[model samples]
Target: MPEAAPAPGAPPHPVAGQEPGGPRVLLPHLRGFAGRLIAVMVLSLVTVVGALAQPLVIRMVVDALADSEPIKGLVAALVALVLGVAAVNAVRDFWLQRVAEGAVRAVRTRLTAHLLRLPVAEYDLRRSGDLLSRVSADTTLLRNVLTTGVFDLVTGAVTVLGAAVVMALLDPLLLAAAGLGLGLGMLCSLIAARWIRPLSERAQARLGEMTSEVERAVSAARTIRAAGAEERESRAIADRARLAYEAGVRVARVRAAVSPLSMLGTQGAFLLVLGVGGARVASGAIGVGDLIAFVLYVFYLVSPLTQAVNAYVQVQTGLGAASRIGEILAIPAEDLHGRGPAPDRAVRTPANGAAAEGADGAPAAVEFDAVSFDYGAGPVLDEVSFTAPHGGVTAIVGPSGAGKSTLLALVERFYDPRSGTIRADGVDVTELSRSQLRSKLAYVEQEAPVLAGTIRDNLLLATPDATREELLAVLDTVNLRGLAERTSKGLDAEVGDAGVRLSGGERQRLALARALLTDAPILLLDEPTSQLDANNEAALRDAIAAVSRQRTLLVVAHRLSTVADADQILVLDSGRVVGQGRHHDLARENAAYHELAARQLLVT
Candidate 1:
């Protein structure tokens, strides 16, 4: 049979708990704090020792009082032991909490780095809110695992064992009866915990889905309101919230079963110890002081035993979250260096090389040789070839879905062609690192999405070291100088999340200004004039003409007027380059170009 496909929304790589040896996902985070953990263990041992000594001290006081001896010194010793144990526990708990916080910090840092470095394809397959949930909610679960789960398991076990040993030595028969009650309770708790982990995993997954719904609603709030979809959006979010609640209730039900069983066992053990010890003491088989000490020892086991059972359940829950976190970390990041065998001619071509030549003997800025791409369903770009020459304007004009923006994407190396090669400065792009290729070109996306930050912050994204004069000049070039003039803060003015505070036209202009700030030899703009008015479009055209004098500009435009004076125009139709030449020639001779021009009344 053919191999099965992975579920939707699953990572490309397998996550922890999906395979053998997956539990080690949390090991790296804990490994660095081994020394601190040892210190906690040592302090816990001290607390156990102090606790064991208390029951014996109480027995001595009881014997002295029965013999009519002074008991003040025994009482004082008991009080001092209690105080010392409390102090040691305080120190141990604080240290553990600090270590837990550090571990969580390390996990968050690593997760953030990994998520940011993931390939664009990965982001396309996953939701942003789900990924954020992993970084926030999933990592928080680990703190309880470290502080309460692992620590309690160790310290609680030691305390329970010490008490059991002391009780057995005092009277073997009573000890046997006490063991039955405690063991049954722990067994019931262990069984209940078996069901909690899986339920917790489902709960976490449901919560992530709910988060995705909220993110979608908020980010598209304007559209939702415009379409009169507020009620529909609210219903969608409510459905996700209800599913998450159901999952949480399932986990809570299993957890609830454990507490009562644990309490019953501990209480049963106490009653058994009382009845049997009373008989032994009256018959003179055991002394009154010894019976009292044995009873005290059983009481000592209560707290730790309860802690141990609860910790076991918590450990299971943490494991569930860990599995989700490990999935993202397991996927290999986009290779910074080129993948596959290195190119035979990895070095740059000389200016005289034919491959480097373009119009007027100048080197080409970007070249596509029979390049093609697909989005897994069908090809987006066929065997297409084009050249964006140095110091020239190469405008890509086509109907919607004709792969105009894709051509620019190929130049920036965002997605590699399934066949053929793309070259920048005569070196194949696959031969150079992504950072190296991207450094040579600046890109403004089609939507021109702006981040939530000040105007200065968004502008500095392209060129952090750009001076104040350079910023002002670029803003003026794109006709966005009015934005700074209107606000008293100038560049310090805030652009709300996704640039909500600015008009669509202003956001487009700001994006262009930011791209212009870069000193890259090539600029890629996808529909930069899509949102601009007639006046703004004319101003932007002038700015593009000025920039093209020194750097190559590859613009994807639907407005025929924008590219009317281009040095070269490539008309794409159904992923194929149907026409290429000066705009006037294509408008008169090319069928696809002529039809598009006629529709816009530009063929006259």
Candidate 2:
């Protein structure tokens, strides 16, 4: 049974410190790309040095023209300086691009590895599209920060500092004017920073939301079309997109305001330098060549100021992306320890206070004791207890939402019991390693998710080492041999997404065959015969009986006919067991069981 719900207004389970919450958190991940980043920084410095040398060359050229002393030397020097700066700029851009790509690759690899390790429960609440967006879009933002943002920050600072120094050298009055304009620009940028950060965060979140909506629509395209809700879904998606657009516009507005204010400060500085330097030249306080160089220096200062502003903006976006990525990485990964081999004494035994164990000394029994669970609505199961013994068929019969599927999940340890312990064999399931537990059980879900691959690949997923002969034998057991033979490629035939290429019954049989190939000690099946016709259901029932002889089977049987011949039947109502015995005995002794049997007959 499912667990009890938390109290009203209680806070939800927090998954803090798992995701990249902002750019700050990405510093650790950036370590792998540090060497590349350093190279990029060095290249940017070279570019800045070249840019600074330009004005000095111009000043020399002007002085040479006035002095008429070896004018050829000044001309050659100016041409060489121009060519050097251009060459350095080109090389630096290439290096920056390389660094960005490398950083992006590293981020994607780490993020993917982290996400794959997260517990199944985290994935249950997350949308595939949102996760995909984090891996794809968020990483792209971080790449921009590495390449464009970092380069701009380095070069911009160098340019600004060089220009200020040159302006001061040329004339103190011109330097003061430029400094005042730079101060104002800095103030405006600081103010804009606060606004841009939050807006960027909002924009990234909205992008995830938009992606989720689109994914939802596409996954349920058939249902939407059947219900004539395409327009409604379209509107919902549009609404999310509009929210994203609004968030982007807010960030854009801040950027728009910041850029112009910085540019205005640069223009003001330029005008002041022109006025002050022109006066100094006219008074003979500075040479005309020096005044010309001072104006050019002001232009250099603007380059760094603009680069600084843009770098800050990229940092803002990167922080937003980091926050989203952090959310995913923060979720606790499925613990790998304590799930290894159980103790020797922990074999399947009731006296050990553990669940049922396998008959052949294999750890294949499943038991739930006083277990309860909920999913925020209410208690789905309360104090429910049962044991499905090994080498036999134990059928769980219940109405819809009676915690049947939840019980199966507990056996697989998909979700731990909230207040009670579940055990496989004599060991507490929590003590069993996840891989060890999973290795022993073959679970065939109701929908039977099939990857987009060849039929042989899907079957081999259960037991990769299974030979062609073994595969064909299992296929025959599920009565899918005819279907397999009919396909042009036999077992190699392509199964579309979720095995949509096959009919419902065929898909179920294929899933059964896959499970059979695993030859695991225990089989946890959810509605194995739900999609089968009369003939296929009978064939599947026979297959289940054959499989149960050597392996333990716990089946969630919706149709009473499916469990009528079971060795033991546990009838569940709400989250409690209403009856337990053979099907006929339960029908005679329990009114609910009798009613359920009648309802099954009526439906059939």
Cα RMSD to the true fold for all candidates: 4.1, 3.9
Q: What TM-score fits each model?
A: 0.93, 0.90
User: Judged by lDDT against the true structure, how good is candidate 2?
Assistant: 0.78
lDDT of 2 by residue, 193-214 (tens): 7687678878888898999999
lDDT of 1 at 86: 100
As a TM-score, model 2 comes out at 0.90
Candidate number with greatest TM-score: 1
Q: Candidate 1: lDDT of 402?
A: 85
Q: In terms of lDDT, which candidate is strongest?
A: 1
**Superposed model 1: Cα runs more than 4 Å off:** 1-11, 19-23, 338-356, 360-363
Model 1 scores a TM of 0.93
Kindly list the per-residue Cα lDDT of model 1 for residues 1-604, writing each as its tens digit: 0011121222356754683222366678889999998999999999999999999999999999999999999999999999999999999999999999998899899889989887656776778888999999999998888888878998999999998888878888988988888889989989989898888888988999999999999999999999999999999999999999999999999999999999999999999988988988889998899988988888888788889989988988987888888888887676677644223312333345546468677657788777766666666788888788888799898888888877777676555667766788877887789888888999999999899998899999979998888898999999998888788999999999999999999999999999999999899999999999999999999999999999999988889899898899999988889999998899889999999899889986
lDDT agreement of model 1 with the native: 0.85
